[model samples]
Target: MTFVIDRYPCEESPRLGAMILLPTAESVPRARRWFRKFIAPYNPACSVGDCTLMISELVTNAILYGRADEGWCVRVEWFREGTSLRVDVHNPGFPANVRLRRPDADDAHGRGLLLVDAIAESWHSGPSAFGGTVVSFVVADAWPA
Candidate 1:
C-alpha cells in the first residue's frame, strides 16, 4: 500500500517555537494534537480549542482549493512573536487576489476567514516569495469574543 500522508512532530519543542513544512491530510489531527502538546508544556491551562478548528479549516482549504501535485505543500509555522501565539499556513498557489465575501444566510461555506478574523488576535496574508501564499495570524493567550 502506498501512503500519501505523513507528519513530523518535533520532539524538541519550546514554549515559543515554529514548525515550517507541509502536512498531509492525516497530519491534520497531529497538528491539533501538537497545538495542545506544545502549548500545554508551557501553559498548562491554555484554551486553544478554537485554534484547532482554525488550523483544520486553514490547512484543509490549502489542500482542497490549491492545485494538487507532487510539489504541493502546506507550510504550518507556529511561534510566539510577543504576548501572542502566531500560526502561519502557507500553500503553493499562484498568487491570486483573495476577495473576502460576506456569506448569505443560506451559504454553506466561505466563512473560514471571517471566523479567523473574529477569533484570532490578528491575521493577514501575503506571498512567501517561494510563490506560495502565507496567511499568518496571532492568537493571544486569550481571545475576546
Candidate 2:
C-alpha cells in the first residue's frame, strides 16, 4: 500500500526543520543537502546541523549492521515539536547487536551512538512497523553562543 506523508502547512509548523523518507545509501548525502534546505530559512538558533550528523551516523550504522542479502531500504525523517527537533532514520534491518558501549582509546570505530548521544538531548533506536528499525534523536533548538 502507498503511504502519504502529510506536508505540514508552513504556518502550522513555521518553526520546523527536517528531511523525510529518504530511500538509499546514496540518499544519505542527499539527506545532508536536504537538511541544509530544511534549516536554511529558519532562525540560525533552530538549526539541525547536528541532526544531520546523527543522520549520517545512524544511516551508516544501518548500512553496516542491518543490510541483508534480501531487498532493503532506508529513510530519514525530521520535524520540530516545540523547541526540540526530532530526527528519525529508518532502515530495513533487524540489527545484529543493539548494545551501547563507551568508545575505547584504541578503537577505530563502533562509536556511532556515542557521537549521537553526545550531540542530541536524547536519542534511541527502535524497530519499525514496516519491517526494519528507526534511530531517533531529539535536540534542543538552542543555537551555539
Candidate 3:
C-alpha cells in the first residue's frame, strides 16, 4: 500500500491538504490521522470527533466499494470554504453504486452513509472529474470566528 501526502502553504491558499491512499482497509485509519493533524492547527469550530468519524466511514467505503482494482487508488482532499470545511474522497468505482439506504436492523453492513448523513452539514456523491465516483461532505462553522 502506498501513501502520498501533499501540503500547501497556508498563506497561499485555503486548501488544507490532500492524500492519496491505496484502496485497502489500512488506509482508513491513516486517512483519519492525516485529517486530524491537518485540521488541528486551524482550531476548527466543528466537532473534530464527528469529522473524524465521517472521514473514517468515507475512506472505508472507498476501499470497499469504490476501487475497481489495486491499481485504482483513492484520493482524499479538503479545503476551507468560508467558515466551512469540505472533504472529497475519490475512487475508481461507479457513482451509481453510491447511495443512502435504510439498512435493516439485522443487517451487519451498509450503515456508513447513514452515519455520514446524520453527521455532515451536507453530503453528496457523484461522478468524479478524473474518473469513477467522488463522495463529498461539508462540516459547517469549521473555522473559528
Candidate 4:
C-alpha cells in the first residue's frame, strides 16, 4: 500500500494537510494517527478522541468500499477554518454508494456515518474532482493561539 501526505501552508491560515492511502484496513489507524498528530497543537472544540474516532470510521469505510487497485487510493484532507477543524476523506468509489443507513442493533457495520453525524457540526458526501466519492466533516471549538 502507498501513502502520501501533502502539507500546504497559507500565510494567514492553518496549514492544510492531506494524505492518500492504499485503502487497506491498516490505513484506518494510520489516518487516525496522522490526524491526531496534525491537530495536536491546533486546539479544536471537539476532543482529539472524537476526531480520531471519526477518522477511523471514515477510513474504515474507505478501505471496505473503495477501489484499492493499483493507482487508486483513498484520500484524507484536513485544515483549520477559523475555530473549526475540517476533515475530508475521498475514495475511488461510486458516489452513489456513499450514504447513511440505520444499522440494526446487532450490526457492527453501517454505524460509521451515524457516529459522524452525531459528532460533527456538519458533514456531507459527494463526488470528488477525481471522479470518486468525498466525505467531509467539521468540528468547531476555540481558536489556536
Each model's TM-score? 0.73, 0.74, 0.93, 0.88
lDDT of 1: 0.64
State the weakest 10-residue window (summed lDDT) of model 2.
1-10
Best by TM-score: 3
lDDT of 4: 0.82
Clashes of 4: 1
- Identify the runs in model 2 with alpha carbons over 4 angstroms from their true place: 1-9, 13-25, 142-145
- With a 3 Å backbone cut-off (N, CA, C), the pairs that clash in candidate 2 are none
State the displacement of the C-alpha of residue 74, model 4, in Å, after optimal TM-score superposition: 0.9
Q: In candidate 1, which residue pairs clash?
A: none
Model 2 per-residue lDDT tens digits across residues 1-145: 2122334448577335434433456766766777667566555574456766887888777667665577665666667677666777777777446556786899999888988888889988778656677778888764443
Better of 1 and 3 by lDDT: 3
Of the two candidates 1 and 2, the one with more favorable TM-score, higher being better, is: 2
Error of 4 at 80 (Å): 1.8
Q: In model 4, where do residues sit more than 4 Å from their true spots?
A: 13-15, 68-70, 142-145
State which candidate, 3 or 4, has the greater TM-score. Answer: 3
**In order, what lDDT does every prediction score?**
0.64, 0.67, 0.88, 0.82
* Residue ranges of candidate 1 with Cα displaced over 4 Å: 1-24, 44-46, 141-145
What is the Å distance of residue 97 in model 2 from its true position?
A: 2.8
Best to worst by lDDT, what's the order? 3, 4, 2, 1
What TM-score quantifies how close candidate 2 is to the native fold? 0.74
Displacement of the residue 7 alpha carbon in candidate 3, Å: 1.5
Query: Which residue pairs overlap in candidate 4's backbone?
Result: 45-141
